[model samples]
Target: MSTVLIVAEHLNGRLNAATARCVSAAAALSPAAIDIVVLAADAATIAAQAAQIAGVRKVLAVANPANAHAIAQVQAPQVAALAGGYSHVFGPSTTFGKDLMPAVAALLGVDQVSDLMAVEGSHSFKRPIYAGNAIITVEMPAGSQVVATVRTASWPEAAAGGSATVEAASVDATLPSHTRFIGLASASSDRPDLQSARRVVSGGRGVGSEDNFKIIYHLADRLGAAVGASRAAVDAGYVPSDLQVGQTGKIIAPELYIAVGISGAIQHLTGIKDAGTIVAINKDGDAPIFEIADIGLVGDLFQVLPELEQALG
Candidate 1:
């Protein structure tokens, strides 16, 4: 009889793949009703996308001009307003959820369960701590609302082809004016999104310079993978910070992850620990990344990359 509501993540007018993964995580709680809340200026378009996520029973769209930017300050209160009648409220453990869910938990007067990796039961769950080094089991207080962030990396995206109902959800809360949407700036790439890409190719300080990083991109494009970078590479001005992958940057779990010239810092390894098949190519055979890599090739990237591109072609 428990009901769960997921806060959908979207951009422009489309749902994020993470939202479907949240639905897949919610479906593990059999017999529980799963619903999604879409908060946007034009929610109908996104709501329709959410409704198509299998395992969802309903989609609630809260359309408002203030919602166009997805500022956590503005959306937290709205999420809290919609938390009623639901025993649990969930969001993806991305930057969006990390910023917003804690506030929702505070408003609900409950401790938030972050990075939920497994649903042991409705109230019992498992999550990671110490940079995913340890997983601990937690139990939500009985009779209290459970607010959690689903770690999209640990679960699979929910399949499409659902026929859930989409309805307009009311938000009667006062809007906060202090938090305003300013102009936004970010790197644009035609390559797959780093976080959701099934295959990824990353570079590090070994890439030498920004121009040399093109070798990494060429290999990535040949493999149809996204481009990623180590913090060192980003700090060295070899790539944009958005491409950095490490404990401090974006965490991803692609099926095939290729590390070219990356020395495999522990911080960097944390980000890709969940990746399915890790292939490390470094000049140093003693590099720590080789210890966990399914395939390790010790060689000079500049020489090896061209050969790979030709072979793949």
Candidate 2:
């Protein structure tokens, strides 16, 4: 039986939705046993949340004074060590997972799989290639334990109900040599995090001007959605870099994605292809954005937008 271990993520005791998705994916690889490791200053809180994630066989709580802030420098090696007995290790393709999992893989001398969408066989998987324009299935070199990061939107989160046993896992207090803790900076946003938002309204070059970009926000606010932008919109000075969605920017898996005036370059599409529903509004009906859209409106965006707001009202 192959043992699979999943790393749990939390912010101040609130379990991240991605952790449950990772567990759901890991369970497909092996149902023999699934251990979810929660590294935190407060074990009881993390453990409580871990118990709620479905398909988990056990919750391994590792409490440490250094984990109060839970930076990767200390958490990676600790998690790598605790996961020693497992044949496979998994984490969500989140900031923490992207930051920490490769280091853990390096410590364990195994190749790390980044942004896996589907597992084919025990060792073969299908993942996006060329900025998600193509899909490639590859096999991991045998004789090594699998270390993978799953894109949360690719897997549906399982419903919660498990008699998962909770165990206290131990870890070294010292930080790994290759990393260090740094001061934190905060971003201001009343909206949900870009990755977690369910409804996203994005603008592009057709937005015309920086002032016109406000329409994106107005629509988003009216719909209770997050605001996003194409690289063209950001590079053209219509929006901030943080709002950009593309190969180099944020990947979003919203329930509804509105692409206003975006040309649907492969890079931008890669970031939002997972969205449940896509609506494209572009003057050029021939724009590639229409290819993936569930609803494509061919009209001048300037004329269409205000009417949309009024119609929605």
Candidate 3:
């Protein structure tokens, strides 16, 4: 039987939903145990939240002042030191995991599995390729510890009914001096986070100038949804690159995804293929976005948006 150790992803003293999604994937393995390791300056709050994830056996709280920030170089050695006695190490396939897991795999002398969507066996898994147009099964060598990133979009979050015990962990790894915490600059928004939001409203180049993006924001606010933008819109300077949703941007699986004035290029479609209900509003009736949209409205967004908002009320 395999023993799985999950790296908990948290920010602002709260656990990320992606960590619970990883728990869901770990549960599919039917492993001997599923434990979460929280590396933070003060892991008590995050560890408490992680313990509530159903199927988790225990939470390992490694409180270190060096872990105040999520610098992958500083944290990888600590995680590697704790990897002994575990058959598998898992992390979410997000920006943080992408940056950290590769280093862990390198330290473990194993190839890292990216975007694991399904578990075929203890050492075999399925993941997407070529912008999600293809899925390939990968098999790890027997007896080799598996290091993988779970695709949070493909798995539902584990429920919160567990009462797992939290244990303090002390890691003795040499910390590198090359990388040091400097600062983080991110746009502050009161809107829902696009990657985790259940409902999202996106705009494209057809939405016109940056000022016209207010229509997209208004509709998103009305629906209490997050705002996203197509790569074209980002490239056109209508919105920030952070809001881009496509192959080159964040992959999300919202229950409701509304694309306004988007033509639905394949790269853009790759991002939301797992979305439950896709609604597209485009002026061109033959727009490719309608091909996959559950609901499509063919009309000028300038005239259609106001009516939709009124109907929402």
Counting clashing residue pairs in each candidate, in order, gives 0, 0, 0
Q: Which ten residues in a row have the lowest lDDT in candidate 2?
A: 172-181
lDDT-better candidate, 2 vs 3: 3
Better of 1 and 2 by lDDT: 1
Tens digits of per-residue lDDT, candidate 3, 1-313, equal: 9999999999899899999999999999999999999999999999999999999999999999999999999999999999998999999998999999999999999999999999999999999999999999999998899999998999998999999999999999999998999999999998988988999999999999999999999999999999999999999999999999989999999999999999999999999998999999999999999999999999999999999999998
TM-score of 2: 0.92
- The lDDT for every candidate, in the order shown, is 0.90, 0.85, 0.95
**RMSD over all Cα atoms, model 3:** 0.8
TM, every model? 0.96, 0.92, 0.99
Displacement of the residue 40 alpha carbon in candidate 1, Å: 0.9
List model 1 lDDT by residue over 60-98, tens digit each: 999999999989889999999999889989999998889
TM-score of candidate 1 to 2 decimals: 0.96
Q: What TM-score does candidate 3 get on C-alpha atoms?
A: 0.99
Model 1, stretches more than 4 Å misplaced?
none
Per-residue CA lDDT of candidate 2, range 185-298, in tens? 666777766777889999999999899998888898899899999999999999888888878888778899999989999999999989999999999989999999999999
